[model samples]
Target: MNNISSISNPIRAPRAAFLGSNLHHHHHRLTILPRRPNVVVCSSSVSTPTSPSLSVAQEANRIGSLSQVSGVLGCQWGDEGKGKLVDILAHHFDIVARCQNEREAVKLFHEIKGATPNHVTYTTLIDGYCTINDLEEALRLCKVMEAKGLYPGVVTYNSILRKLCEEGRIRDANKLLHEMSERKVVPDNGGANAGHTIYNAEGKKFALHLVPSGILNEDTLCVIGNGVVVHLPGLFEEIDGLESNGVSCEGRILVSDRAHLLFDFHQEVDGLREFELAKSFIGTTKRGIGPCYSSKVIRNGIRVGDLRHMDTFPQKLDVLLLDAASRFQGFNYGTEMLREEVEKYKRYAERLEPFIADTVHVMNDAILENKKILVEGGQATMLDIDFGTYPFVTSSSPSAGGICTGLGIAPRVVGDLIGVVKAYTTRVGSGPFPTEILGQGGDLLRFAGQEFGTTTGRPRRCGWLDIVALKYSCQINGFSSLNLTKLDVLSDLPEIRLGVSYKHINGTPIKSFPADLRLLEQLKASGISYEVLPGWKSDISSIRNYADLPLAARTYVERIEELCGVPVHYIGIGPGRDALIVK
Candidate 1:
């Protein structure tokens, strides 16, 4: 009777309860069988057959394994699915970490996804974590999160380490990185994925994109266009410098002249490109900025400093003038006449040096004193040099990197990058914009937004909002908040339309902006516009709060919030700064 109970009695079943009524085979079920001694059956109808020694070894391997797990970095530019990935991984990690880059991804995703799941919580994307100078606080946060039963992942660890390294805290970051790896949260060795190649008929071409150096949070990884190979870790450190570089407590509102120069200068060239891209739809202002920058890159530029040595500058200027004249040999620009203009610029360069200081020095000092400095960009992200529609865009980093290169301040000094967007979309220059609204719809938005250049007075080619483009801009700029401008312009519309995405030609859906102009045109031709929301009717200029706005206006703002995946923290009723509504 004892042997029967021990060997064959179904009453003494496996302690792990192999099967029950709740077990649904259709939903993937497991079965168990009895075995002698410590042997037991598992759900897969398979036995592990592991001995006690093997079990110990398996546990040890799991604890010690340095397996690679992907952390999302930006896919394209900045806002490439980073927020979504970070949010998803936040559940498994103690902290949602970042380096220098802001949480454009998280902010945008939160705006899109709306109310978070009960299990989810907010985490900071430390704007300049690499240079925050307070590794202790960041590490404490990680510890706090861990104390709550979460593990710190690469995003969190790398940012703190990057800042430490930037502050000449290399040893600290390395130690942290090593510790993170030991905990199974591997450090990202700053590297970019295989970037997209642009082929020309002339030869097999590849992009000359810039890649960053340093350790990166695993979350941002993508092959960008051009030759830009970004090491996110390095970028994080640069950003850390900006964040920690906090401005000095000063009374004056300082402006970065370099940025202003780039803005004023690039506008003309970019406008020309826009004019070319606009075809017959628009006019462009021919500012000599493009020629100037191109000349500078080719070592033929007349610098502002060259003015003090005017005698020598003009000789070099003549060579560039002659070269430019050759390129535009048969074009509208007169070669001989333009050479005289070069002399005129010499006088202008002489008068402008008093305005040029080591701008970075004063700006950095102000940052140290915690002064407020606004680094306003001239052109939109679509017109950026490396990331934007190439050959048709501006020759500068109008995105977040512009702050670094333009200001001479580290990434950590600049805080809270705000991205400005027009409610409906308009593109001034040429490229493949899938959301371009043509015919009457485009015409209406153009006229309503008064979509004309502030400096040039040229009309902008209008269309529905380009969410894809907007997202890209948000990512590259490290936008912490969004200023949704021109909401009042959409009031009179009976209905509104938005450009959601393109009907990709290759039978595959691409969420990103296309690099090939012809392919972009095809996408534009075949693209689909997703109209999910309607426009507002009320005059929103008077509305000062998010709740007081008209339902339609609120809905419209919310829709944009959802679309761009970045919250509209502030809305613009009109062009004036006073016309802001804070949500």
Candidate 2:
């Protein structure tokens, strides 16, 4: 097998050849890749198992090492036949992964191989519109991909780069690079800390000061991470009447099976009189919202919708939870103390009662009322169950489409998708991020952004705006408008810089976003190529209009508009809801 080289060849020729001469002058430099390559059958080294089955342990091992190699197959451009390679390789692998690339990668992978529909793992779909450049078709396909949950990866970047180069968009290219840098986004690649202690007057929140007087509150630190460190300072100014709900402990909580019985009892009363009685003890974390649905699927769970058939619902839940508890008991709990703590949560379940309702009915009524509801996503797009970075992704979809699944709403009612993005990109868990900044700067972004996990409270992985990745992300989410938050963080800086396309990765041109971690690490290690912009000293927090802000901030926003190809519907000057400039 030929080992793919870590280095890519840079185009030594003039821009004319990069886009083929077969087209008009505007698109002459674009490289249109060949769709799919023929499959070459490779002999398998391992003998087929005679039993056609394996032990649970063996199955786990098989799935864990699904991909034989540690690296990814990449091309200089999109049509490098990666899909064909993935299809060919899937025979030896358990799953194929795609992100920040076109959805075709997965579609082609399965199409060519005739894999079962169940075998393919489709994740997030992103939409893009180069309507200004007549690339709306590509963007539309991206939305379809998003609906199906197949994420774009490096190919998306390569295709866009090829498109820009073909259009002879040198100025736009530079601007794109500039926006990418400030946002810390790589053109084709998509890809936190502690403090001095100060508390709000409410004592519910604390701040950390690294600089001598940089104001180290938790909220400010959440925006950025690193700077000079200081020892425990005296009690700082507090916000009047703030409630401190900070965490100081961790353990598991268990719930009992009898919790479902309360709903059944309520059903018997018809008016939920009993259900109302138990509502006080529900102790529901609301996270169990999914668990109720899971019970219905197995025909062993109780749902309020099934309350009309309470006799069946309670019996089913009782059987399932008991079986679950019995199985859980046999499993080793390592420490007795841990087991006891878990039982405590389980015991708490008895005190609570759940309501039985056909949530589907509630949703249908909402539709009838024609109400405008904004479904709050529990997590970021990166943690989405399907499109996210695989096993690392969350168990549920949090993207726009998640609204349909989570709430059982018809997709037709969904209108005007608005995407909320920070000035810089952030991800909570592990995944391939091609443009992560390291060392002092990364630490700085972390400290400044207070980049901690909102749910996990663990530190987040911070980087510049990854246009390549964000493009894919926005496309999947069908973003009609963007609310860009935190442009003011760049305020007071000596000079603000944004990432552009890289000159090379490991001595080679970064023609595409490389997936190999070793190469990616090296590409990131090469540091970033920044397009510096003058910083503004004015406080943008008070500015309400786009044109009314300082020229520098306007220039920054305009430059971003040009690169993203999407208008900034709203620019956030501060964290508060009112701190927005709607253009």
Candidate 3:
């Protein structure tokens, strides 16, 4: 096979004439005709001409004329009769080339051949688009290739990276590199507690909890890594829902065998734990994520792999149930409950068998194979257990470190980390929101942004963009770039505010996001400092290019970049994928 990289620019043939006369008992003639300005036609009388006496220039002109005729014929007719023509011309031509600029070429090829375009076709087209410096179209083709269950190889990614680098879009190039290197493992630290709302091309919303956002791309393997806690029933429900909506899940979704199982009892324990705290209840999704992790840490947890051995499953269940029962007086445990739970789990185990996998090996194997993995995080950094506000945070680490522990991947392989932040700040549950906009102001943002919890459906506390918190998140994650989402949410407001910093009640500046709950609560009450900027006050939802956005909107985006020291590469003007402005 000829390498596309070695293919030169389009060869232009000179307009020439070919003439032949009748010879040896037959009247034969060759004619050269011009069909259009750039098209040429040639007709030969002789079946096979042996012209040893012809000059080299004349021979070259004859061959070029024939090639031009073949190109014209190929363009005039569809794939019909193209094969016979190719076979006949195969001996004369060194290479057969097709126009890559034809947008419907691939679709036509598929329709005519009844076969999908192979990797070479996709890569060649992508490279061709890149050569012409149409990077946007190149990227779109890449996505389309992936959507058809074809993964882009190294050559394909390199072509895009090279084009991006040539254009001085280093951040975007780095982002592509990160996607090329990382294997996205949605770790054990998060379960179905967090939710990501994604909008499809048709404007249909998918509320994903357990499944990664990568599910939208057909070729992407969504792995629930070892660090994640799996709630099998919830996982299957999500799978069924997706499949019902025309998305396939069978071979695409993988649940790590080593991931601990979050049972219904774990959720009961979680609620009981919260009830015990009463007035000081930590705002949890009551999804049993914390209790499941607690079981894992305590060494009494049941992993997804345990379901394979049904014989000892009952014994393991008894131990877990007993542990929960002993802790809470309100908890009731009996033989009937155990028997019922065991029967239910048996069904769950049978259904979950196909999805279970040793993800550690899968991830490592993919890395070795040079497959691009995109890690999709469940929660924000501020909601991390170790790094986030104490007691108020979720049980797991939702920060950069979680990618390693959760996915069983080496830290060195983790590439560019892009933080997705809203145009304004909003928190679902209880925590110190230093930049909170209270009363009517908060209501305006809340209703405008539709700041409701995806998992819990609770009203989120809306506020101005908190630069202090964002900078701290950047510092923690070392994000290469930031994706500013929901910028269109602020279109209705006359002015927008960014919480620039925090201060003490007595006028001292708080430099960083403090971990102390007391200090955070104090700051939340009256210590936030704000920098107000003018809003665009016009709808920007239809914008796709960053340059087309209003000056005020661009200023708002750039100001955030200045404050956080991270480039805002992706600006989400609206919910749909097409609404994102690549800055």
Better of 2 and 3 by lDDT: 3
Error of 2 at 570 (Å): 1.7
Candidate 3 lDDT over 157-241, as tens digits, reads 7678778989999999878777877744111211122355565557766665567655655544677788777778878888988
Ranking by TM-score: 3, 1, 2
Per-residue lDDT over 423-482 for candidate 1, one digit per residue giving the tens place of the 0 to 100 score: 777654334545666556665677677654332222346666667777777767666667
TM-score of each: 0.50, 0.45, 0.66
The runs of at least 3 residues in candidate 2 whose Cα sits more than 4 Å from the true structure, single-residue gaps closed, are 1-315, 322-357, 454-457, 497-523, 526-532
> Which TM-score value belongs to model 2?
0.45
Error of 1 at 555 (Å): 1.7
Scored by lDDT, model 2 comes in at: 0.37
Ranking by lDDT: 3, 1, 2
Q: Which candidate leads the pack in lDDT?
A: 3
Candidate 2: lDDT of 230? Answer: 9
